[model samples]
Target: MRETNLDNGVLILSEKIPGVRSAAIGIWIRQGAAHETNADTGASHLLEHMVFKGTRTRSALEIADSLETLGGSLDAYTSREHTSYQARVLDEHIPVALDVLSDLVLSPSLRDSDLSLEREVVLEEIAQVEDTPDDLVFEIHSERLWNGHPYGRSILGTKLSVEGMKGERLRELHSESYVGENLVIAAAGNVEHEEFVDCVASYMDTVVPGVRSEQVAEPSNALAGLELVDRKTAQTHIVFGAEAPPHSSEDRYALILISSVLGGGMSSRLFQKVREDLGLCYSVFTFQSFYRSAGMVGVYIATRPATATRASEAVRGELERIAEQGLSDVDLDRIKQQVKGQVMLSLESTGARLHRLASFALHDEPFQGLDDVLSGIDAVTCEDTLRVAAQYYDPGRHLELRLGPS
Candidate 1:
């Protein structure tokens, strides 16, 4: 991996992989839903859609065709922390990918009519979550857990906020946070570092060198221990757990290991016991959401309303068992290998590498190579896992958020 900066302070990171035919280039802007004021709640996401509508030099159709003609895909997504615009194509098409990506970020034409249509599309997106119990469960979990902190704000924003977003507000969002200081451009695959840097530097003129600031507030885990929402659905969607360490915390590694043991796969405690043994739910998994100064942990499950309480009890029982009994050395070693295997396997994809390249940089942390990551996991003793479990896995401490009929 190689890193450098354009004159305008836009950081560019790249890795050249031999024996590969594909490459992924992405532009990451540090601004996201968390950075917006109440009025501009969903503007970051809306702007992500608007940029694809057209640019100063290309219409939406042209932008759409720009990569499809090369048998590539250009896409973007807005998250709680940042927005990413990415392109994936064969090695020979890196230049085309770079050109289209640069145009989207540097020259978006946020037209009023485009915003009007995009608003409805975004509104539907917001509505779609209600219909998706799995998604709606977590959405409500965050809303209740964080209690109005930026972290709780939905990436899709509310109906009133989306409707209130003006073209000018979007323009302000782009012009302000999408500058060089808040941008990290990264690529991976069969591409040279110096050449990629040169191509990126050419955009220096329009890339603002000015600094952009963010006001980050870490929220207290104020949601009640249990809250059940009534919705007319077949099954009850549940999310349980509470606050955990951030990306920078050393406990971060232990948290990852603990979550995997809880619900990482078919062999995981939650899956084996909840589905295979009790025949409770079809989907059961653990999740960890990390941010700059805060993070969250939740285990999600869905089951028939009649068995929802049973499934939830099974989940809490598992947590309590692990926290009290502690993981054996054998269990600890197995989880480490499981995590290491997943990491090594994921390296085969250039898109995954692109995400790592930008993510660490955006979080203001040094990149952890495969060896470093594996070693970190290896160093996690059984005591470490037990410590984290004892700290965070108490049933009385975490939140139990249920969505669907009582």
Candidate 2:
């Protein structure tokens, strides 16, 4: 792990797992949908789409062809708190990855034609999410849980925002939100540290604004017990959520443990009880969305319309039991081992390592090494899991979202 500061912005580049044939390069920008107001909602995600249309020296096809010709792939995504653009290529094509990333991110044209076309694409995407029950469930959950805050707003914004967004406004947001100060360039696998640093610095140095962002606030909200949507669907999509630790919190590991125990795999409680034993549903699992200022623990289950209520109650019962009785030593040990193994296994891949380094640099300090991560995971004990379980995994705080024939 290596840390460098370029004009007040931090860049963390980690080169682990030597001699790999492939490399992963990523840029993590701190600003996301959460940073937008009512007027500029979805600007972050829209700008993400616009970057692919054209850049300073590369057209959309040029960017695509650059990576495709090298036998590599380029992908990007925007979330509630961050946007990431990444490229995976052969180790020999590392320079090409950097070149394309710099051009798209630093020099996007955000042209009128591109903006107009991309806006339609994004609007269609928003409609797609609305039409899909699985995706729509999470949006409903967010709206019900974070009801009054900017965090509750959709990442794709509204019809009005998408329709009204222009080239100039999108470009302004690109400058304000995707600056060097709020960005981190990270690459892992078969790359030299000095060479990677030089490449990133050369591109980032051309742009000068330093890391300056508004103060982030802690998210606090009362959980709702019931939220239902009557839709013409064959299956019921259920989402349950509650407060959790932010990325920087000490309890973050505990949150991870809770999620793992609940639905990390076939051996997890939700899977074993809901799927293996009662055969209540075909799919049931839990996840943790731990962010910078706040977080949430969510459980999602999709089942036939007939068994939706049963699955919902079973999920609630599992939460209540865990909260009331705490995890057994045997169960806790199993989860700990699984979590540790998962962590170690992920380090083997360059793409996972690159994303991990970038994510940590944005939410916490850039210098948090894998060794530190191992130490933290190792330090977790059954008592630590119990404490976290008691703190944030309360059943009464659980919010439920159901989408189907109600």
Each prediction's TM-score against the native?
Answer: 0.98, 0.95
RMSD of each: 1.2, 1.7
Error of 2 at 66 (Å): 0.4
Which candidate wins on lDDT?
A: 1
Worst 10 residues of 1 by lDDT: 215-224
User: CA lDDT of each candidate?
Assistant: 0.88, 0.83
Which stretches of model 2 miss by more than 4 angstroms? 8-12
Residues 27-127 of candidate 1 have per-residue lDDT tens digits of 99888888887777888999999999999999999999999999999999999889999999998898888999999998999999999998999999999
Q: Write one digit per residue (lDDT tens) for candidate 2, span 108-176.
A: 988898787899999999999988989999887887798766677789988899999878888777777
